[model samples]
Target: MFPTRAYSRDAEAIVALRDDLARWQVASGIVQWKPGEVTADQVRDQIAEQQWWLLRDDGAISATVRVLEDDPTIWDDLVAPGTGDALYVHGLMVRRTHRGRGLGGVMLEWVESRVRDAGRTTLRLDCAAANTSLRAYYVGLGFTELGEREFPPPYKTLARFEKPVG
Candidate 1:
């Protein structure tokens, strides 16, 4: 639940989910994530701050994602001081076994509901610019390109995308 619970009761589970996603990303070589890219403390903080969400089925964590209202590293150039208010997505992932099952769409649908409830109009995200397939996947889901940004470290470039949610 994103924006539902303020803090995660099970911090270990959140860390495990992130580590799993990072490991999968590395094994798949489709993303720049390494297993330790996100630390336990960060996961705890994300959960405590209500930015992280977990989807469960049969009482186990099936997927996880993050939503934010601000992302300075990626959106700084495009947003003015008082006008950068939109739902931003980060680290969206389904378990490797659940990847081809359309869970991503379900997560996006959930996000849309949250955005609507918050009276927001846009849901935005950034994907690695080198990841053509990933970019196409989001485009297929009807997210339009806002622009691209060159980052200084870790990430080289990212394509900004947004879809009207409300």
Candidate 2:
């Protein structure tokens, strides 16, 4: 069985998890942009805001996700206004060694639980429009495509998704 642990802000485990996420983001081809550009300070800020979570297994960080309290400005043109009732997820990544073991779904469920616990009615996230497989993965997790928008430079088109939570 896979044991999971929740890590708090600026914890060593979380730093390691962020490093792992940077590496996987490059290797997975999901991020054509530079890796390791997001600093520990940025991560700590998110964590301090209660917007980040690090999931662990066997004492090692296995995955990381950020639950945003507000909808990103970039997504404003795509989704309808006043959608802040949902928690927006960002930077979800699983370590390469543990890929394809169903951990992604587990992490997603955990995110859903967090939304429900917060009295939120929905969970939302976005994927690069070019990443069809990644979009499919989110859909498999029960997220429905809401809309798409083009963001200039570095990152281009992004497809937004949302799933209702109880």
Candidate 3:
């Protein structure tokens, strides 16, 4: 099994990782996270809420993913608030050095197992609508494309996907 753990502290590490990825995305023309958009305090707050998790590779934080009981802010159009029918996934990221080793799938599978263990039947997630590669990746992972959701300005439309779990 992979070394997976709930985020406890060290919010700075996660912030740095996010910023690094965001910067890379900007350089690569990926319309994802914007550099400096993720704050340490935000990460710390999520950690306090026990919504973030980490995956370690050889004692290094190689990947991270956040799981929420519900994401009404983004999925309210499809799922009502507090429905508790699905677990929402966000920020499933792998370091550049760790990219192509199936870490993303491993992290997602870990979350899917957790959702099943918690008696949830669905795993939902979203990404920028324009990111076809990522959408394809999610589809390849058994996630069905639900639809697209429009958000306020500065935020692009988001494509939502869901996978049925046991």
Predicted structure with the largest lDDT when compared to the true one: 3
**lDDT for each residue of candidate 2 in 78-129, tens digit (9 for 90 to 100):** 5566665878888777777888888778778888887898888888888778
Number of the top-ranking candidate, with TM-score as the measure? 3
Candidate 1 structure quality by residue, lDDT tens digits, 48-157: 78887777767667776788877776787887534545778987878777778888888887888878887778888988887788899999999998877888887678
lDDT of each: 0.76, 0.73, 0.87
Please provide, for model 3 over 15-96, each residue's C-alpha lDDT reduced to its tens digit, 9 standing for 90 to 100: 8888899889889888878978888888888889888888876767899998899898998877889988899999888999
TM-score: model 1 vs. ground truth: 0.87
Q: List the residue pairs that clash in candidate 3.
A: none
| Candidate 3 residue spans exceeding 4 A from truth | 6-8
TM-score of 3: 0.95
